[model samples]
Target: MSTEMISITSYCLKYDIEGSFIDSLEDGGLIEIVWVNNERFIPYSVLPQLERYIRWHYELDINPEGIETIQYLLYKIDLLKQEAADLRSRLKVYEGTK
Candidate 1:
C-alpha cells in the first residue's frame, strides 16, 4: 500500500533471482509477502535481511531450513546483545550511585 514496498516480480527481474526463492523465504517465515490488488510485494524494511538470505541461498548454497535456523540464531543474538546493553547501563547507574 505504501511507497516503501517493492514488487516481487520487479525485484526478481532486477536481481535475476527466481520467484520460488521469494516463495520459499515466505514459506520459511523468514519474511512477509504483502499482496495488494493481486500483486505481491515485499516491504523495503526487509530488503537487507532478504538480501542476506539470498546470499546465503545463492552464494553459500544454504537451504530454506538452514536459513530458518540461522535467522533464529541471529534473532537470539540480537536479543542477547540488547539484554547485555541494558544490564551494562544498569550497572553503570549503580556504579554512579556509589
Candidate 2:
C-alpha cells in the first residue's frame, strides 16, 4: 500500500494539537518524523496511533509517560496475540499429521 506524507504543521492544525507533543512522541520512539523539502512530515500510517494518543491526553487526561507505557503494553499484547495464533496453527498442523 502506498502511504501519504502529511506536513506536521498541517496535521497539528487539523488536529488542534501542539507540535511539541508530536516532538515528544518522536523522542519516545513511538513515531518518526520525516523531512521532505525542509518540511517535517508524518506518515499517514501513524494516524491511528496519533489519534489514540490524543484521546488519551484529552479524554483520559493521561500524560506522555503514561501514553508511552500504554503504547508499549499494547504493542506487547499484539505480539503475544500473534504468537498465540502461530502456536495454534502449528498445533493444528501437528494434529493433521496424526
Candidate 3:
C-alpha cells in the first residue's frame, strides 16, 4: 500500500481552515496528526473524512462535539448497512438450499 501524507500547513492553506481548528480535531480524538521530519502531516487516507469535517465546521457551523456525534452516527449507519448486506447474503444462501 502506498502511504501518502499531506502537510497540515498546506492542507490548512488550501482548505482555508485555521490550524487551531485542526488541532482541536486532534485534541478531540476526531482526527490524527502524524509528525514526520518535524512536520505535521495527515494521512491521505483520511482526506474524505477531513473534507466532511471541514464542511461540517465551515458550512454547517458544527462544533467539535457535534462533529463527534455525527461521526459516531455515521459509523453506526455503516455498521448497520454491512449487517443488512450480510443478512441478505445469508438469506440467499438459505433460499438456495431450500
Candidate 4:
C-alpha cells in the first residue's frame, strides 16, 4: 500500500559498450516498470519511458521527490470505495424503513 510513483524521462541513460542509450527496440526491452496503478500492460510504445523509469527508479532505487503520491492516491481510492459501499448499505436500510 505504500508503493511509490516515479517520473524520469529527461535524464540520460547509457546502453551497450558504445555508451549511447538504446532508444529503439530489438535489444533488451527498453522499458520496465511495475506499480500498483500499472497492474496491467501499458501501451507497448510507452516501454521506453518505462525502461527509463526502471533504470532510474528500480535498479538505482532513486525515487524522485514527492513519489509518495501513489501511496496516498491508492489509500484514498480504497477509502472511497469502502465509504461508497457503506453508503449504499445505509441507503438500502433507509429505503426499507420508508
The lDDT for every candidate, in the order shown, is 0.95, 0.90, 0.91, 0.46
- Candidate 3: misplaced stretches above 4 Å? 96-98
Which prediction has the highest TM-score against the true structure?
1
Q: How much lDDT does candidate 3 score?
A: 0.91
Tens-digit lDDT string for candidate 1 (64-92): 89999998999999999999999999999
Q: Per-residue lDDT of 30-77 in model 3, one digit per residue for the tens?
A: 898999899999998878888889999999999888999999999999
The residue ranges of model 1 lying beyond 4 angstroms of the native Cα positions read: 93-98
Clash count list over all predictions: 0, 0, 0, 1
Predicted structure with the largest lDDT when compared to the true one: 1
Regarding TM-score, does 3 or 4 come out ahead? 3
Which of candidates 3 and 4 reaches a greater lDDT?
Answer: 3
Model 4 ranges with Cα > 4 A deviation:
1-62
* Tens-digit lDDT string for candidate 4 (24-82): 22134443433344342234456555455445544665443322344356679999999
| lDDT ranking, best first | 1, 3, 2, 4
Judge candidate 3 at residue 84 and give its lDDT: 100
TM-score of 3: 0.80
User: What does the lDDT read for residue 40 in candidate 1?
Assistant: 99
Measured by C-alpha RMSD in angstroms, how accurate is candidate 4?
A: 12.7
